[model samples]
Target chain A: QQQVKQSPQSLIVQKGGISIINCAYENTAFDYFPWYQQFPGKGPALLIAIRPDVSEKKEGRFTISFNKSAKQFSLHIMDSQPGDSATYFCAARGAFGNEKLTFGTGTRLTIIP
Target chain B: DAGITQSPRHKVTETGTPVTLRCHQTENHRYMYWYRQDPGHGLRLIHYSYGVKDTDKGEVSDGYSVSRSKTEDFLLTLESATSSQTSVYFCAISRTSGGQETQYFGPGTRLLVL
Candidate 1:
């Protein structure tokens, strides 16, 4: 069974436009939500993360809006650039576990000029 | 890659053969993990090691095994390769300190089974 579900397996957006990717997890025990960005032939890298304590967190043009009550979180990229075009994955983790992470199926985001 | 390196960035082998992938880390992080990434399935943890000779299975531990004899090296072996095992494998290291946790991944190793 997939614990974390992501939508829009693929996405395309105009340069400088806003890009949003959404994900929802079933396990309420999840306390940490993180987004990872992966380039072709590379491993996923940590982009940004948010704890359940915060409703939103922003870093540069990237933002994560989290709704703990809804068990959902979304990533918003303002002024999406071609460099930001890559596979994005959302993950959740429980604090009590062995620090294992449950990742989403991934969303491929493309920013066209 | 946060000072992590995975050997054999790419490999091609036939089914029924044994295969091994190696992950080496420069930092002596106690936590090391092996995960496989497949389309429509995302990344799934296969196994992880908390210290030398101390390891545990993950959700997808079937058909795979791990060994960590030193702080810097973790090895994942497939007793007999299968086509279903054709996927990109990643090794990650984690650090838990000061009430915070950070995980970093290696470039990845692509394996193919015929």
Candidate 2:
């Protein structure tokens, strides 16, 4: 079973426009939610992360809005740019410190200039 | 970039043949993981190692095996390669600090099975 599910397999937005990607999880044991960005031929890199304790966390132009009650989270890019175009993945880590991460299907974001 | 490197960045092998991918890290993190990325499936963990000679399976551990003989090296081996095993593999390392753990990934290794 897919513990985490992501929507909009692909997305396109104009430069400077807002870009949003959403994800949902089924496991309540998940405590840490993190977003990763990946370019062609590269591994996914950590973008932004949020804990269930916070409703939202913002870093630069990247923001993570988490709704623990709904078991959902989303990533928002305030000023989408061509360089920001890439694949984004949402992941959930269990409460156990040694547990492995559970990742979402992934979303391919494209920012057209 | 995390001081992590995957060997044979690209490889093409035939079905039933054995294949091995190596992950080397310089950070000395206690936790290491192996994951495969597929379209629409995102990244799925195959196996992980918590310390030398201590390993465990993940969500997708079938047809694969892993070993960690040292703190800096983790190895994933395919006893018999299959077309379905063709995917990009990534290695990640993490250390728990202050009740928080963050995973850092390697570039990746692309493998093909014919």
Which predicted model would earn the best lDDT? 1
Off by over 4 Å in 1: A96-98, B96-99
- B-chain TM-score, every candidate? 0.96, 0.95
Residue pairs with clashing backbones, model 1: none
Q: Residue-wise lDDT of candidate 2 within B1-114, one digit each (tens)? A: 579999989999999999999999998888999999999899999999999999999989999999999999999999999999999999999865435787888999999999
Clashes of each: 0, 0
Instruction: List the lowest-lDDT window of 10 residues for candidate 2 chain A.
Output: A93-102
Model 1 RMSD in Å is: 1.3
Clashing pairs in 2: none
User: What Cα-based lDDT does every candidate model obtain?
Assistant: 0.94, 0.93
| Candidate number with greatest DockQ | 2
